[model samples]
Target: EEDQGLRFLQAGTALGTHKGMIKIPVWDCKKNQQASCDLSHRKNMEPVPENDTGQPEWDEESDYRACTYCKDNASEYLKHYRIASWFELIEKTENLASHMIQRAAAFSMQYNGGNLQLMCYPRFTATVDDLMSDLDELEGNLGFVPDLIILDYADILLESGNDERERLDRIWKKMAGMAGKRKVLVVTASQGTRKSLMSKSIKTDQVAEDIRKLAHIDLGIGLNQFVKEDERDERKAMIMRLSVMVKRHGETPSEECFVLQNLGLGQPAMDTYSFLRELADSWALLILTLIFLGVIGWAYRPGSRALHDDAADVPFRNEDPEQSRPEQSRPEQSRNDHARQDGACK
Candidate 1:
């Protein structure tokens, strides 16, 4: 499946402890349906009278009836209906407001009281130049440049008549230029190529279209799922492999395995068993080669017959115990005393 850009955006925005503003430009909505609060249907509706219960009184004619009394009281019935609709609207508005407030409170509590302001552009679809113009306008209005700008999906911003590669390259260059000019981080996402779908791992080369896009990015991460054949018990947790495809400063061409805990949030997996299995698999050929070499060496090793005979007779060699022992002898002083005594006797 293709990458879900919106899910990633939501996950990324919620990650980390730093508090900052996140501006999201949604280009999918139509031009007329811009703001969340714009209620076009409310234009034809009239305000309802205060203290008016929605239910009709016993003496009042039902609005649905075709009697003369109903026709005469049509205005009153219409007023009543409007009041009922107004009441329903108020009830719905209250429920929505309450939900939003509770959600905000919960999010605030979860984030340790730090606030993250999320600003969304209404029905925004623009080219590179148009985006730059909007950025300039925003900076002018806010009196300062934003710290971060996230383009939801870069592939959708291609020009009308240009080649795909050329357009993408131009878009990336403009994005890089914006980052440099504003001194702000510009984050964007793109999908992998069709070939990457069947692959076990994703790399920078698997990125859609021209690989030159990697040159514009400081860091690029490729995410892929772990494929296994066991389908018996289907409750196994989902595991994903994340590869560091491109890194301008730090470690690159590295991999990390993780289990998805919630949404796009993943926790590092303890892969000791998997690591050992992979290690053994990777060394199998080398180990076999070494074993073959050892066998060849044992069969054809250059060795004299004399060397083998000497090694074989080492355990059987014996010597006389008496010949190996040293004999006891008298001291020189004792000998000298004896000689002196003999001389005296003479």
Candidate 2:
């Protein structure tokens, strides 16, 4: 896949070749590298017939160079130098990409444990403009636009125009523009300057190509892992620190968090263990104070006096039903009875 020269590879399901679906996938690797074959058809580049001029023409493309053999000396060598090597490199790169994707998918399903549909549309060697165009083509082919587009990395993109800084600015500006225009999130990474490697923290200035690249991003996180000089990977479980360099709408975080990781083994994410243990302790103390205040307020609250009185009378209630009833006086009835008794005696 490419656009720099006439050399290209086309990707599609035509002629019993690569296949793609119209339905949107749950997860997608939306990217185009520096060189890419458009999704036109599954075929190689065919040179157009022209006048028999001994000019150098599109022969083949390799990772290192695009080997262009003159038509007159086409048979003088094996098509072009390192023609076979180009295919071999392509094979290796593809295999690595597939392997990493498979690992990530398996990890997501097994460890994360969710039903997810994954799709990868990989093309290589395209500039920033080519990437945007390819995105349009990809959406049109899929019949649905992707919610997210993850570029492989921005630094490797082919340069355009005259100025170096301007080229870098254009790349990022277009990326931001695409995100807003298409209403899709664009995620890309950039290489860091040499000084950033040793620094415990990363800033916008630490970014390579153009420090102004940070201006376009809404949110930016800097990954810091202390790697020593001439150090070899011992396959140990190392931790990486995350610092928030920019926030779209909120204040930048002064705190950082640590991620237990071993990316080489395809194990990157784990539960975050915060570096602000003291801050956590302070918050815990504040929560306990609130609970104490709540309890004190409940005991001394208004209208609680009646409830306390009812509770106090509960223990004093009589058990005998007869004693609990009221007794009535009958002095008039006694006097009447006495008078009747005297008359009977007389």
Candidate 3:
């Protein structure tokens, strides 16, 4: 019932195709689970029939609701969503033999795991145009653009021992340009150690205020605070705050938001678990195969034994006919003698 339709201006294939070309909204704010639906079909659908009085047949609010797959649908809802971790993102998008090319390709959003919604970039290295071009290609390829973007492991970019600050500036400028075009709204999820350029250069309470002033959502998160064992209470509060902030930024709260954490449960764990599951499944298959073989053997063994017993009990065919011939000859012999005596008397 959750409306899995896109909000669009028109009806039919033309509208769907147009909406498809637009950036897919991203729910990059910090949350464990969220989703967005393409309500274009439903939104563009003709209003239901009205009575002779010319009033709506059903109340719009009560008639429409979220669909069953609302959560799953949210994963790909963004025009471009960020990879949760740099290492994992790099491992998936980067080729060890051709790391640079692969990184470039990833930044361009060329890797297609058809089912996955999130994409990653190694720390920001390219210029604003370079980043936008990459975003453009990703949107074109994925058929959607993320409304939300995250700068992953941003601490490295800021403190890589070089003039990382300038590099950071270029990234922000690119984001500002994109926002101006309404192509995207950016948020950076990073550790508290590195100061953000948005804050330092602008001299604001929070680094994101500049982007916020430009009508975009800007956010900062401390990895330490997010990763603590005793911070559930704080984390819950933070998530609620993020939801509100994202909504206030003119982004559909469910579409543009992000929650980032380095819980040490990255791709390795995912791969290991996948491998273990496959192993368990193979073992189960082998056991089932053996059981089937045993069943086949058990069913045939009785039939084989019965055939052998029947062969042993059966009399020899040639011997049976010879034994029956003598018994038959005795009766004929008496009839012949009686016929000879009657002839002699005649």
Candidate 4:
């Protein structure tokens, strides 16, 4: 299984707190084919072809039904997804949102859908055929045929001890094979060379093993973002601006696109919280009114009256004989001491 556990203690609590602070409400109508105000949850889940709109069709047969109904867990009907990981340096992205997040183009890694299966492969010894055999077993047993496959590190598939470039060449071809044979989209990652790390953007020439590795890819986008020392501290670096390095079809626009992200919340850039700004705008007056009322109530609460009265009298405490009685001897003692000092000086 792909371990969703975090490394540090209280990580989950900290992340939960962060998520609570960001109040991005996902309405059910937007997530379903039915626009419902009072929609109920569906019991059973089944696999279905998903459209790119990111909404869930709760009823597999209800595509014709109105999507205007607000779905409670509209996204709950997706196919059983399992996170399968192998003994490799890389990780796989199983969903379109995650795929785009890694590439820096999308948002939201919610937990309600898809079973992610993480399969561990032997280090630098397994072959693509061995991978196919395991996948075949997975399908035959679990009835889980993936539409997408992510190979954490292809270098582990074969001996990486010799012919680095040629090994990369073989590795990419094998990835292509997995895609074609399984009829699924295969995704993997490649790190940049040391020189490329220093550069603001990684170029095709900087691809570690072989630039030709991209030759087999349908679309390739280079990752880049603002990483000034100050910006890194502010986490503005999560605002990713990606450059399209290669595209199999269509013109590659020179213009770039950005996705503002906060992974601490386990969310990609969900509309960059632009929708949140709209929400605030729509409800600003009410929100402000409630806040004002709360402050007023806190200030005028029953106990606060006595507290404020005591504070108001603090400046005039010396005028009240009863209040000053406890300290009446201090000044006389100080004066007597000063007189004694004066006499001694004389």
* Model 1 lDDT-worst window of ten: 82-91
Tens digits of lDDT, candidate 2, 5-73 = 111111110011112221110110011111233433212343221124521122224222322232112
Span of ten consecutive residues with least summed lDDT in model 3: 5-14
Model 3 segments more than 4 A misplaced: 1-124, 153-167, 194-346
| lDDT, ranked from best to worst | 4, 2, 1, 3
Candidate 1 structure quality by residue, lDDT tens digits, 153-196:
66677455558888788778778888888788888887888777
Give residue 269's lDDT in candidate 1 (0 to 100): 37
lDDT at position 38, candidate 4: 31
Every candidate's lDDT: 0.48, 0.51, 0.36, 0.51
* Ten-residue stretch with the least lDDT total in model 2: 23-32
Q: Which sections of candidate 4 miss by over 4 Å?
A: 1-115, 122-125, 226-236, 272-346
Error of 2 at 210 (Å): 1.7
The candidate that wins on lDDT is 4
| TM-score for each model | 0.43, 0.48, 0.26, 0.45
Q: What clash pairs does model 1 have? A: none
